[model samples]
Target: GAGVSQSPRYKVAKRGQDVALRCDPISGHVSLFWYQQALGQGPEFLTYFQNEAQLDKSGLPSDRFFAERPEGSVSTLKIQRTQQEDSAVYLCASSLALGGEMAGYTFGSGTRLTVV
Candidate 1:
């Protein structure tokens, strides 16, 4: 794809339901990231992966949230037992550089998840 592509642009989940959001990054991009954005708030880092190795996931809100990039191309973020507080826009981004290297991130149109 020419740019980052995310699936299910909008999602509505009932409380306690699980949801998986997918992100297909640009070809050859080595860094993939996931973020959570609350209503009217800036995106907050959720996790980061370098290639197929997850480098940082300290920002994830809880154990209910998990992110992975198995082949270094496509990534999925799964949320289990979704809560009302979990309703937010999930953003995915990718870059060509490694950690500490300055590179512009290409972001996808986030998947907005609403829990009710």
Candidate 2:
């Protein structure tokens, strides 16, 4: 893909349901990141993967949130037992550099998950 692509641009999940969001990053991108963005706020880092290794997951809000990039190209973020407070826009980004900040990032439009 020419840019980062996210699936199910909008998602509605019932409370307690599990949801999985997918991201297809640009070819050859080595750094993949997941972020949670609440309404009226900037995106908050959730996790980061260098290649296929998950190097940083401390930013994830809770154990219910998990992210992985098994093949180093596509990634998935899964949320279990969704809650009202969990409703937010999930953003996926990819960068050519190991430290994403240095190379900037290409972000997907994001998946808007609304819990009800």
Q: Backbone collision count in every prediction?
A: 0, 0
TM-score against native, each model? 0.95, 0.96
Pull out the clashing pairs in model 2: none
1-116: candidate 2 lDDT, tens digit per residue: 88899998999999999999999999999989999999999999999998899999999999999888888889999999999999999999999986666769999999999999
Worst 10 residues of 1 by lDDT: 95-104
Model 2: weakest 10-residue lDDT segment is 97-106
lDDT of 2 at 106: 90
lDDT values, one for every candidate: 0.94, 0.93
Best by lDDT: 1
